[model samples]
Target: MPRGPPAIEKPQLEAKKGKKEEPKKQVKKHVKKQVQPEIKPEAAHGESNKDRRKQVQKQTDELFASLDKEFPVNQMGPEPKQGPKTPATPTLMSSSSRPMIRNPPPFNAVVAGTAASNTAPTACRSAPSPPFPQPAPIAPAPAPAAAGQRDDEKRWDEQRWDDKRWDDQRWDDKRWDDKRWDDKRWDNRRWNDQTWKRSRVQDWRWKEEFERKQKEMDEVLAKALAREDAAAKMAQQERLAAEAHACMSQQAAMREEVAAQRAQQERLAAEAHACVSKQAAVQAARCLAWTQQCATVSREHEQQQQQQSDAPKMQQQSKSAPKSAGNWKHKNKPQPKNCHTNPGQNMRDGRRFKEIMQKNESLKAACKEAEGRAAEAEAKNKELQERVAKTAELMKKECKSGKDTLEKLMKQHEECKKELKERIQKLEARKKDLKERISALEAQNAKMKEALTNEQKEAEEQKAVKEKVHRNEDEQKKAAKRQKTEGPAKK
Candidate 1:
């Protein structure tokens, strides 16, 4: 196999590969021994040396030819080496050595081309020798590091490679870093979204729990209110019952008093009946005594009549016989002076007996009339007592009915009071609710009024703007007309 150029294995490549080979050692020694910086010769301003100009032009062409084979170039540096004979062609160069052209071109281009041309100036009449091998391309500089860090200029020189290969490696590192940063950002966003979702769920659960608790509390309050109402109703009923009982007791006492009065009236009537019976017995005894006196008087009158008839017969017989003379003699013989002494006494006794008998008859007639009047009075008294008993019974009945009506009225009054109280409470609650509703409505009206006022202000501003625009347009129109008219006049 053919051996390649010694310039291919530069000391820079050995440092990058980190190899200790024999060829790399030999190359390092050779590079260290020939440590010279190449310089391009400048042209003189007024000299007319055609040979020197030709020599400089030839060296610059050879330098460009070797660089074209080894590396690709887009543009040359601003400051370039100028030749006296011809201008140097602008050559493309790698980034690492682009600045070095201001200092020196590489040793390979200088030694291979300029050395022979300068030494054998006369031998140039013959053809030139074969071209020297090109130098290897240099690597690009690395990107700037983090803050407080310096760019590694030496490392760039040590790892010299082609510009294309270095650009590919840089692009790969940039792509990897960008992908890692994007993944980290995406992960952080995902974590934030998860936390927000959990918070929302917790808030919803808490709201539901609060609503449930409120409902339970409301139900408990309603139950307590109902219990209180029931207790009030029961107490009212008990009070009514006690009132009824008291009324009944009062009625019983009244009935007892009425019964006692009836009993007293009955006893009075019995006493009056006994008095009438006794009066009747006394009247019957007086009638019987009067009848016996009248019968004895009649017997005495019959006896006296019989005695007078016999005496008259005897007197007629004696008057027809000698008894007449005897009676005259006996009468004459009893010549005791009766007409002069006993005549007044005998006459007074007969008159007094007749007056006493007439007085007894008048007294019996008066006693019978008095008995009849007493019987009428007793009958009138009995009628009055019966009427009083009937009136008392009517009064008792009225009292009992009155008591019953009073108890009913009392019960009705209690019921009405309870109903009125309930109505009042309901009305009060309704009043409160209506007041709250009215307040809310008034607030809404106020808000509406404010909104309407704002709208009116906005409308007024729009109207002013429109008016201003119209006035401006009219002014412009007038100005335009004046300009037209003035143009004709000036012309």
Candidate 2:
């Protein structure tokens, strides 16, 4: 018999001499009432095992209440406490004598009903015989002095007890088989529980690891992005610097070229000025020489005019009966000494006149030559003066052009300076912006590094938690395996 709560006995149908018909009706009515209420609508509708268990519990509770009321157990007092004594009842009608349905009826009885019916008869046959009846109520004892008969009797008694024990052992073996099946089911449930718990722990650990890895990857990507941005900004700045340097070099070269041009213009002007001064000096010297020569010619001409006047007067007096010639003839040749004296005197006078005329003609030719030279000199001087004025005007124009060019160059230089200043300011502003950006990037990078570190720490903690969970799961599995291996051996 299974070791558990005693069964509820159903009273045997025994006919009463006085009210057999009425008692049958009453018993049938009572059976119908009990059966109708026991088959609950909610229990029949239940789907899950838990719901079915609840239904079974409700039924068991009802049965237990009914049994407890029908056969209440008396209280026993504690030690040193006096309790009232009650009359002793016969043990013949105890829970052990109840008709027990050994194999519990299934909640869904339809499926198990046939099998239950088939096994019920067998179970009844295997049950112990009632205590009221005995096959041999009296047995004659063999004399103690007769050894052979006594030994025979004793052997027969022992054989009978052995057969009874064998029957009881067979019944006990069947009950043990049933209990072993239930134990196997309980063990399967426990193993499933352990597997579920371990799987849940593993799933949670995997989830944490996945999250940590994802976070780490995000941080790495962000750092890479920040680095790329910084590199690009630096490259841009380098390119700008190269451009600015190129511009400055170009400006310096242009300024050098402008300076060289201004110097060249100044040198040309200086050379032109020198040539004008040299020409002017030569013209002045020519004019002075021509004036002196003209003065000398005028003085000589006046002297010749005075001499001509005296010669004419002398000729007139000689023609008339020249006082000097007459007087000289008288004084030198006494009174008349021939006309030879007059002839000789006339010849000498003619020769002197011819010489004077030759001298005058020569002087006139020289004066005409001097006047022509003077006129030529004056023309050359005027031409020189005109050339000098033209040169001066050209120089003035050149100077004016140079001044304009210089002014233009100066304006350009100022403009270049202004542009350079603007460019410098722009570059400075850009540098400031880049510096601020770099600082911001640095701060952001630091924060990212810090966040990455924090994530690493968290990941490490998760790994530790996962390891601990794995260890616990391993231990639980080991214990479960040990229990499984030991269970049958213990049984």
Candidate 3:
């Protein structure tokens, strides 16, 4: 039984009854006097009694007025009777002794009736729960016990109390059944049969996908590597081509320089030859002048000898005629030949002078010829010197030109070498980039494979959740579909 308040004794109820009796007696006296006056003379004899009644009525009315002044009658209602002073003993009642209490009528019943009259059939159909019921009272659960208490003991006690009248056999059977049940049986079975199969299929699919992707990556990498190799080969070829071109250019330049040097040497040789020829011509002129002087001297000597022989013949004839008388006179008067002089000697002398004059004229003509030849030789020599000087200047210019050309060619070769070096550097950089990219792709592929492995495991879990028993078949269908689509798309 539930605990109850202390019981109320009989003495406390009697005391309350005695407190209410005075007000009841006063009301009876006031009503009895008014009714007795309505009867005949015999009732007139009850005038005194009526006076007493009036007096009681007045007192009662005054008491009621005082009560109304203190506490209005309109505010009065039946007061709740106090319970007995002693605690009440608890009593257990059967279910049949207590009436089933229904909910009270709402204050808006008339308003609801009017609204129901006004509502259309369609409106009424659409309105859900038109007559709402009062909400039920919610009971709070018992508070938990303090720490150090056994929770199982507390729960057992509460259950025992709540089901106090329940049959022990039924309770034992229900408890036994609940205790024997295994909640995870279906989950474990489903995971072993269906989820494992799904996981296996998914793993196979993931492996195939990884293999295909790896092959694609390998193909792309190979193509990139081939392109890089081709670029490197092209660069090498260009470098060799540039080197060969530079070598050929150098050889041609050397040959041209040799040719120029040979031409300069030939010019110098021709100049020397011209100088020797001029010297020889001057010598020949001098020899011819000496021969002419010798011829002139020989002619002069021959004329002198002939003149001496003629002079002696004339003198001998004159001497044989007169030795005595005229000899003194011939001696004194001088001989006629002696006086006249020898005509032959005079003729010879004249011839000799004429010859000498002719010889001198010839010598003078030869000297003039020699002078002219010497002058011509000198002029030619001067001209040759000038030509030599001009040739030397031309050779110097040519040499300078060759030097400038060689310098320009060297600069061009240096620039080409530099360009080739730059191209090689670019090729090396491309190779390095391709190597790095391949490494990055490999890392990404590894990461993707790890993720796919995890995803396949998760898919197995999801398959169990979705209760898909034929997980392997579904996976195979999906794999086939993906293969078909991906194959066409790749092409």
Candidate 4:
């Protein structure tokens, strides 16, 4: 098997955590021993100088041949060695994280070896540090491999000039420059993509969760608003019902009052009419009796005068006087009183009659006024009765119209024209039919839902049965597959 050049194992560094002093001492010691190996004197064995030269020549030839195969002559720099890569994710830190400063390992803690030794840690040639977090800059470990070559140099003094060319640190610097080792160090794009993919899921989940919470809140608010609206509607309905009851009671009271007023007015008018008629009859009777008495007294006085004036003529016409007496009439006072035998009695009676006549006149005037008042009262009472009847009819019509729907009230309003009202009425009828249809449909839907629930239950039972059969089939298939793959004995 082909293998890389063998390397001498160097001393390991013991850098304690949170410590610097101890590692510094160990590193110093390590550097001293590794850089300067002990030189020992050898006994002279008579080996030929030509044989040593031949061996040196052969090693040189092999080194050149290996170099030619690894690199073309055009590429002046050696190809950078690749180490086992670590994922960039391990070095990542959160944005809120503070930069951490740690104590670096002591310089030269690791040992240096030749390019052929694969285990050696490669040193970055550049002094500039990377922007991102990385391992601390490690100083190159000292190389003590030149001990064997040094012995060769001491033994063969002629080889000093050639040995010095290879021994100088400048040659090592040129071979291991910064640019050569920096190629394909880290992939920034891959780290960025991984970070974006990782955070995207969390961002989407948070967004969806926020939206769901908002929807729930909105639904809760909607339900609260609906409850408030329902409560308000209930209160309004109660108020309207109370008002209607009060209005009905008031109307009933008004009807009773109107009937009572009409009855009282009719009774008063009848009483007034009867009283006026009775008074007029009494006045007529008194006036007629007074006129008759006056007429009788005047007739008697005329007869006595005729008899006294002509005693011989009256005795001759006395038989005829009885016949003419029946035709005798007398003029009289408006309201006469009986005259007594004395003139003073006559004057007194006249004065009494005059007072009586004056009283009769006043009574007639009063009767006339009373009749006028009665007529006025009757007219007023008739007007009130008509008014009450009209009011009752108006109230009845209003009560009847009150039972009408909102559409009727809208029809009466001036804002709604006849054409619009007709259209509205037609639409209302259609809406009523639609409502009826919807109610019927809803009833049917409820029945259907019940039936659907039964069907769904049956379907679920069938699905369960089907799933069981499928499970059995799958189990059998799995058993067959298992038996075919692992053999039946394995189970």
What TM-score number comes out for model 2? 0.32
Error of 4 at 204 (Å): 4.4
lDDT (10s digit) by residue, model 1, range 224-334: 765676676667666776777766776777677667766766776676667666666765675676567656655544544455455567568657766455567645554
Which lDDT tens digits does candidate 4 get at residues 1-491?
11111122221222211222211110001111111122111112212222433465577668657856764455433222222222211212223221112321111111122211211122211121122222335434333435544443243332322332222222222222211222112122324543553465356446556755775676576557656755665565565656666666766776787678668767876776776677668767866766675566456555544544555663565555555545444212131223233457656656766766676677668767767876776687678778778877876676665545333444443333454456556656765775675577557556654654665465466446545634654464355334333431442
lDDT of 2 at 203: 64
Model 2 regions more than 4 Å off: 1-341, 468-491
The local distance difference test score of each candidate is 0.45, 0.43, 0.45, 0.43
Q: Estimate the overall C-alpha local distance difference test score of candidate 3.
A: 0.45
- What is the overall TM-score of model 3 with all chains considered together? 0.35
- In model 1, what are the clashing residue pairs, if there are any? 73-92
Model 1 stretches with alpha carbons more than 4 Å out = 1-223, 297-491
Better of 2 and 3 by TM-score: 3
Q: Give the TM-score of candidate 1.
A: 0.35
